[model samples]
Target: MKNWNQQEVEILKSKGGVIALANPYDNLVTTGVEPWPPAEVVQKLYQSRQTRAFSEEEKEKLQKFNGYYSDFQSIHSEDAITWSVFGTIARAQIEKRNKFISELFQTLDLESEAVESSEIYLWRRIPHPDNLVPSGPEIDFGILTNDTLVLGEAKWKSSLGAAQGKNKDKNQIQLRVEFLQKYAPKLYPGVHNFVVLSVGLNNDVTENYTGKTVKCISTTWGAICCLQSHPHHDELQRYLAWKIKNTKNG
Candidate 1:
């Protein structure tokens, strides 16, 4: 249902060919699915907050408010164009909270009871190590339990490295771990890392690059809608392949 692009082709090759993804639905047959919430509820919670097109007035507001875009008119950036992707990430947390956060943990084989008891958090601001005002990388979403923690970063069409950037000690994931260690030492050493992205990346790349420090999962509009929408294995495989082939960062 989707057309292939260069990035998708490359990602497929990187992941040992497209054969496995070719029929991803096969794996979905056994995946358990909870019924989705009603349409109105979903609309209220997850609807995109972006205007269909960026109008002159909206551009002026962004230029005035978002410092990052102050010079947007003078200098063009593809990244800037996609900045609103964060809206998708926020909506995902608000609407598909359970499916994206809790269900994903279950899919990853995290402890059932712990995941069931997990709470989702959106870290828009990070406090300094000294417990000062928020002053660090902004994390997207997190799932926390008494002993287990899952840190997540969301992106629409960017790789984890691109989205996270290169920060030595202030990395978002590192910040989260350090925060828990400093405040709630009990949750230390119980960290599980995740990246929710809609781009041309595979688990193999994620595991190899991070040395398995984090688990990478795909999302739609920054939500884990692939497996959640597929009640049958066949549909899962098809939709997954489609998503992988379509979502290119550039």
Candidate 2:
């Protein structure tokens, strides 16, 4: 039997979709749009990275492909889903965006009010607060408001990654909570609302980690699709449903 990634690629191809290529990366072929919805936002954030760290290999890979940050064509791309769901919401019209965010917080059972403005950062690198480790975890996506910060870790066909090098004591979510408590204050002072959202196939993603002050919650891609019921999200919803069905069959 073919593995999950193979199956996903085949499914996309069968539906007239194409895998993204390094040379002249085309978002139209990969994600059904010439310019991704979050293109401008991503470019702005990437350009503002003064202290962001990337390994030599990572830098080389990024230089080879402009689409490496989004990577929507990859079969197992969590970034793709993150961009589709949260990014879409962030870029939506003010009323619609506020509604979507309110729904999201409601889904997670967190008390929140819609904000006039917010920022969504994809793959944000937060350095270690006290040099406890060489580097800190790169958050999958973070939604920042005037009074709240929602840090998310999205997974597709995978579990939460193991602890960083030589740091087996804390899992991925724990590390993010550590950043929220220890490091995030410096960046967004007086922000009391700290939430760690785990987006994955199931609620089990939240079973491994707990935070003292940060509230942690898990929701599946399907749930997000349901909440974000816009025409733009139809393709993603269908794709995730297919993956879930196939995964269950296997």
Alpha-carbon runs more than 4 Å astray in model 2:
1-72, 130-135, 208-212, 228-233, 245-250
- Candidate of highest lDDT: 2
lDDT of 1 by residue, 45-68 (tens): 221233223454443443332222
Residue pairs whose backbone atoms clash in candidate 1: 24-237, 25-233, 25-237, 29-233
Please report, in order, the local distance difference test score of every candidate based on alpha carbons.
0.36, 0.60
Estimate TM-scores for all models: 0.40, 0.67
- Which regions of candidate 1 deviate over 4 angstroms? 1-102, 114-118, 129-133, 145-147, 156-170, 186-201, 204-223, 229-250
**RMSD after Cα superposition, model 1:** 12.4
Tens-digit lDDT string for candidate 2 (63-162): 4545333344344446656666666565556666666666677777877656666676677677764365546777888877667789899987677777
Model 1 compared with the native: what TM-score?
Answer: 0.40
By TM-score, the best candidate is 2
